[model samples]
Target: MSTRAMLFACWIVTFGMVAATVACAPAPVPVDERRPDPGTVVGSPRRLASYPALYTSTSRAERVEYSSRGPAGEPTVVSGALLVPRGEPPPDGWPIVSYAHAGDGGDPACAPSLSPDLRGALDELLGLVSRGYVVVATDYQRSSARGPHPYLDVASSSANLVDAARAAVASVPGASNRWFAVGVSQGGHAAWAANERATDSELRLLGSVSLAPQLDMTDVATDAARGSLSPERVVLFPTLVDGASSTDPSVVPDNLYRGTLSRRTDAAAPCLGDSGAVGTDDARAVPAADYAPATDEDRVRLTAALDARRLPRSPATAPALVAFGGRDSVTSPERTRAAVRAACARGDRVTVLERPDDDHRVGISPEVLDWITALRSGATPRPTCGPEPTSPTSTGPE
Candidate 1:
């Protein structure tokens, strides 16, 4: 080879080697002097798979949408809002509280709305967040495009709530693994259900709070049958009956003559939301006792389920705070007390508080507030229930 060609080849080899060395070199360490603030690290923005595109606005609090893997390859998407403190992040993993709303599948669109009349109850969400705890509220199954809310599908909804919390921690900055689950009315049922079924490895659930929970469907239906019940309560019974019957066929009468069975079966099918041709108003007009399967048969089935105690059987490994209104006619406090006792027997750290004067709609009472404060401060709450005097109160509609 010519001397010039040999020299050029050598130079090319050297350049290639240098390029490779530079490419493989470790990156310079970030300046220690500019290390990220601990608070910032805790509050940094994060993304997780299955989370919906986050929505933020000057007038409204930020919102997130996300999906979770469900049983049997069924993936369900849930939408929720993450309420952070106004200016700074909490020092430790911020305590988290997940709020489950009550009744007829709440509307997710109202999550960030500012109007008090609408879903914009920023105070509730922001209150906890401002107090150094992240607040997450899910739209659950029905709130989004996801159909088949499965309103009473205790296991499914509970799982969705848990998965949403996990997703929130992944997506929100400075979120902590410690969490509390709370719900009122229908939501109260959800809180209890989630606690019963939650796994230790999946959530470090610090506590669960249930307010005026609908504990025994059988009791509620019986009350409605004996007298004039609220249209809402009356309408909800059939759905519960249908769900229970679907899960356990024995809940329905086996010896009912074929004609009677057909009539009752037809009435129960098509679920509340999916009852096509029959309008919501029409469905609501049907009295609980007037349904096809004789009221006695329906009652028999529901009573059996309650006697069998088919509620989520998983024991709550974390502490639980159960509150009920003394005057809650919608859901019997007696039943709630029984549930609290059961939770205690299951070895859960349990606290039961009954506000003698409060009704179903009043938000948390002073005693309940004190209990929450104590829990957040790391005090282990003990179960307590009694007839305390009613206090003045106001809470938004369920």
Candidate 2:
């Protein structure tokens, strides 16, 4: 076995021993207020088939099954990764970066922990881990659970993101409870929502970095149902319908797709880059128009779910750095800007990064890193909300 694999084995055995000892020891009648809860680790972090090879700066990268609350407030298990830096941690422990990845279809196989490649946000995560920040990325319950992935359900996914941090602190030897959230696209919405949800957890949320978050899915879902969704975003229709089906029984494959596309066994078959039902394969070929709801009631049911998941569900729990691209077809720029405005109006300190020429794929750069570094150094971020053409900290196209 490799050294990393051996280390993982040792951690599992040691953790098991500690757990057994704690279980056997007598406990006080009352809970101890002075001691902070170390959070919940559902199972020991095990060695993944692929580990640190993708993250050169990481000394240890392992897959962990962590505890989280589901949509209806029930206990659930989710999958995630814990990436430790290359050297010894600071006295307080290594500060954490809880990452939320974009939608990768509803399939468990699309999970980042299962794949060797980080995908989409590799460079950003690589930079942070290289700079000594421990990183944890949640696959959300949908990726690891028994049902279709709730594509944009911020509440549940954000809980998973924050709980991933809790699990890291409970499981990783030197992982600090101090943490921040970072995400892109769907993940961006998750990160922003996690910022609000983190206040309830034991972990300290310093801030969040959100890139191209899909704030209000209601408009987009409505567009898809009405056959008015922009061509650029039509590829996402299947996933949206699948996600809507996860929450509402009324929305199904047969009523949402045409002919063979509706006949496919796997309703949620598209895996991010693959155009499952929206492509030109004769077996299941169809135009974007074919992907439509059977009735107006189906559209209403889908829209209701999307509306409930809108961002700023409550005022943000921490200051944030939100970057929005003008040309983002997947997430409406107008809606994102509106959400940010609403958050600002609600007394949240949000620093905006408006890149007018960029698209849905916003590049992570040094500026974003500098902002995170400033927060770590105890610098207060200046809020950027004043006028219509808001003055953002970073206005240049990225």
Candidate 3:
């Protein structure tokens, strides 16, 4: 071949190699389930009880198996426990508080059913029950069962939570229909989503209390890339992104699951245990920025899906009591404010509280206590530093 011809051949070979690499790479997953549509319904709510505890210990915690009509189900079963104070059986059925938890390693093997630690969180659940409130908690659809737990599939997740609350009221002995929702991190995200999507008529949702909710995955991912986030969050972000992207067709499976991303892919399997074990290395190897989508189309679609799957829209219908740690490095307070503002604009009542000294985990209890106090008084809870001055204010008079 002549020199020019040889050069041309080399260029073709290089192009082929690059194309092959691209073709083999995995793309992000898109959501396959229908996004939440808008509508509101009010219906007569009923209550019944069933057994959810297999172990004697769980049985002692006021645990019950409850069901509700949700999405496409005969009845979705959720496990919940009522923690009413020693003597008070809760007058007028007591108010219901539902909790949506953060990612629980997404493995069925390591589900709350199997993990001692998760079961321990039940202590908190039972604590709320003890406070003369019906406490409803869901393992979320995918995480509880050994199936695809759509990590951020807000609609389905919210549906499961709402159904679980309905079940808890009927299943728990002294429970009533007056309800509120609360969650931390992943659970907070679920609570937020459920609040937005819940049918107004189905359940009398008073308000939602969220602690350190992971409202913006993209923002969290960006912070993780900058080394400003925790190691656990860095690891968790990709798993969520991958899980959420799995429903989209434009996202190539291989590209979505390739390289460092694949290391944490197994984290979504719902096997009961520490997901950190499987994803530790991947967490260490990649930076958050590197994990973001490269193309504009990919970014746009991923962001749209994330926004669509978020729970901000529900703030309009119910009052929201949201708290975040000022020192929170995992889920930024600024982003949380943005989400709160969006929800408020939709006509939902919202309150955003910030604890300047708290980190992701420690600052939650105080907020919860404050929320309980506000709800009991029948007054809207106010944000600590006043309204997020940069964001929108609550429509309910300050």
Candidate 4:
């Protein structure tokens, strides 16, 4: 055969083999484009409970269930509460505050909406409502979404907060389009993330306030494993495992914890308070060596899953007020400063409030309240990124 014809025949044979291989390959799964957009409300806010005379400023209290994005970006129902003020709103409408509460464990009943005290933030919520702002607090997807709660997952909490803001404004009379994201501890992380995530929605996020935000869960876990965590902070270990497993199923409880924690029965219960409710009584008093990861692979799996959930995933859409206390060992000041520096480097306008003398309880300070007041009054806040000025100002381990 001619050289050209021989080459052509060889080419045809190679092409046929390639075609056969391609045909035999498994079909790729199609992306589900029909998933509802993040923050899309799935249903009307069902009345869970009400407090008519809870606070003088709040004419009424409405706790309800709404819809938000789950950890996997799927639409799911969640719970929240609204504190509407007594008086008439301004011509524009009453400003909104999307309040993210600190961590309350991974159990469904740990939801703030179910608590009569609003998860110990009643005074704070009442104070906000007194200022003529309608407050909206999310119970997070852990309360209603399928699967384990992604404890520190920023995306899930951000979506929940933004969607709660949307749902609250729609459900409550005289609520304005303008709003601020405010949170403490885990909620603080959510507020910081919502500042970035809210840009996707039509909500006008005036600013964000993150108090002692748990920015680096990987570091927290590392500390816990090294026996360096405080006794008060040790309770967070199970929630971290649950959170990692939720985001990445390969990092399950059995893959990480030992003894009582390896089993789901005890580990699945509420874990935040001093109640002997988390795991077993022995689990609470056990050495870090007992509850820490079983193997290096398990540790690596947990680290990767938690690291992916850290904050400042992107520059925020609006200015942020970051408050941290120097003596706060739970959510250490060093980690918070590092997160602020990273955020500033990424073009986020962050204002820092540092109180060297205080500990983790420095959140909801007078200065932070004043900062919110100034922002509500249309004043542009200057970024506090450089050397933090030594002054007198943080939350939960989350």
Candidate 5:
């Protein structure tokens, strides 16, 4: 089918998921605080026959299933895609990029490779493939793995990202030894975690690029505590709690889900699908005061969980390209700045850029490819260890 027809079909699928609410809550699940063995390897990679709907003609997409630890730290099979361009590789091999998808709802069918592209992800992948780069995209453990999807578990997602990179090397030919990471929103946080976690890994992470990453949890809990969260944001608050509660028993969202809020959550699907979160008319009417943590204990738990999953205060081993949208409403520019400030305080090597006109979805400038190219060529990557820069500097090769 034509691209327009294909997109139309995808749109139909997405709109249907907009206001879907599942009955699931994180506090009652049987699993929580379970830690992975970290060294456990349970399965080998297996390839699927069909590619996703948006798999472009420029590259061949291979759907592969591999094992990864779940949010509650259980091991299970997870699925992903490895796209190898159809041409000769550079002398060493194609440089690898692990692309993490943003929130697509907490459902099995939400895996990027299993459905049509969202947010022009296919176009981005096509650009990388056309440039002879190998793109290894993870469906994350929850979307295709054997458990309820892990919405925001940092440890689990980061581990899967590193594993996904390793899986690329093992499952595809002409995959290079060099690896770089690029993530947006939730994926940006994942990229940050991988940045810290991969310091001791077998696969090398040369650097990372995070676009409008969700940085501070203190801010999140504080916002909720003050009931200042917007209606649109209130919709995602449970997801934040649910993800934390799944892995940390202390993080309970039940206290807040007492009445009408519970009904709103019950009606909304996890991941909110590719259409993103849609606030109900009721949800839109919710005052900020109604969005607070149930008790001091839950508030403290949210604080701890946020602290545990936040970006590294110490410098990551590799260089980083950090970007934020000046006008972003979701992962606000201020939060991104705070994270970058903390990173700078620790003497981490990072380059800050701002898309003054873009929102969260269009953060980091399109020159992210340029950032990657600059890193690969070893011409850029300056440290922001001293006084904090007054503002973001747009980054692209000269």
Candidate 6:
């Protein structure tokens, strides 16, 4: 794994929230019964627990625990927030944006649905929604489910996001079919996954915008074993392992935390920063080499799972705009550039946004806002590829 992958796995330190979670054994959820469409809402959307949403004084806010399913065919209830712009619709109704959030590790409280200040962590959503777009973000399954969240379970995260948008269209007044996605960090990965999968769903996804996404899990895991993982990162290992194992049980047939990093893993249950309460000494104590998967079976499973998580698959049907900080410690900018090249090689209509001065929290810049506007207006965004002094297309205000 490159330095960025190590930084990416350890990006949990970037978030400013408390962690709270309990380990859960990987279990088989019932096969997700097929709906008419992958993004179909499971049942009636309940508006009882609505929170103070963006535009509430102007628009409206509501928290709904909607019924949605996973790609595996298991039935589940996912929590999320939906905000509709106040005032009259624009004839055809409001153009919607399915917002995917950054990965906040395993803490359920950090999930936007349960967040006390929903608009703060994701101020970007407020920016877009205030401009007349209906925004919906999912809290993901593991946060509210019986088990640990499968951090990068591509199918589940993608499903959670797509269904949230689908629910918005059904429950929000004047919502249109012209929907797209914008996500950062873990969410950036989900946005990309949704784009790959959305074409087959009932919803019409025009495109997606991803910022500093967690693209290569293999790179991340490799660095962890090298003992290169930071103190903040080591604490997050359990969730990554647990999530991956849940997605592919063969990866860790046995309990991963029953051994050395037990308390550190347990401490990771809550949000970031505080996750260190379990201490950084344990992470420093054992070298990643010592705990390398011993058996051939373990090696095979690890290899396969990593291969599955690499980004830039071929034949993408929609437009994608991806951005990452030039010096991002979390996920490498080089990886983003590589994915851009791979996407181009695969016939994907993609664009690259490189920020020389940014880091893990890639604030949505002005260039990004303009890119979104261009996409909304049907203008093909130009790819600012190639190395050198190209900076984030947009930053802060115009």
lDDT of 6 by residue, 1-398 (tens): 01111121221111222233221112223325453443445444433122234435336666665566663746676667777777888887788888877665555444555554553444667777777789887877753334556677777888788888888887777988788887888889888988887864456787788888877656555565454766545655665666676667777724333355544344334454344443456557756654455555565576577567667664555778888888776676777777788877776767777778987678568877777777666665655532221333332112
Best model number under TM-score: 4
lDDT of 2 at 395: 40
Any runs in candidate 2 off by more than 4 Å, and if so which?
Answer: 1-39, 143-146, 259-270, 274-288, 386-398
Candidate 5 per-residue C-alpha lDDT over 1-398 given as tens digits, one digit per residue, 9 for 90 to 100: 01111111122233232222221111111222453233232244333233243344434665565556666556555566677887777787888888777765545444666554533466777677777778877777653223235665776887777777877776567787678877878888878877877764567787788877776655677778877775546766766666666667676667644444554344243335334334544566776556678787777778787777677655677778787779877776877888888887777777777778877775434567777776666555444444333334334433
Query: What lDDT does the true structure give each of the candidates?
Result: 0.51, 0.68, 0.53, 0.70, 0.63, 0.63
lDDT measured at residue 280 in model 4 versus the true structure, 0 to 100: 35
Sort by lDDT, top down from the best: 4, 2, 6, 5, 3, 1
What lDDT is reached at residue 292 by model 4? Answer: 69
Error of 1 at 318 (Å): 1.0
Model 6, residue 356: distance off in Å is: 2.5
Error of 1 at 120 (Å): 6.9
| Runs with alpha carbons beyond 4 Å of true place in candidate 4 | 1-55, 143-145, 260-271, 278-284, 386-398
RMSD of 3: 14.2
> 2 or 4: which has the higher lDDT?
4
**Per-residue CA lDDT of candidate 1, range 283-384, in tens?**
455544453344566656666654443343667756666777887766766777677676656666566667789767745555666666666666654544
Q: What would the per-residue lDDT of candidate 3 be over residues 1-398, giving only the tens digit for each residue?
A: 00111111111112311232111101111222442222111122212122233122233333333443332332334333333334445467667777677675443333343233344466676556455665556655442222234676766667767876776555556666768778888778777877776675756887777778888766543443344546556556555664565454454333322355554444233231254444544467665455555555565565565665555654344667777888776677777878777766665556666778887773336446656656654665554323333333323322
Model 3 lDDT vs. the true structure?
0.53
RMSD of each: 17.9, 9.1, 14.2, 16.6, 7.9, 7.7
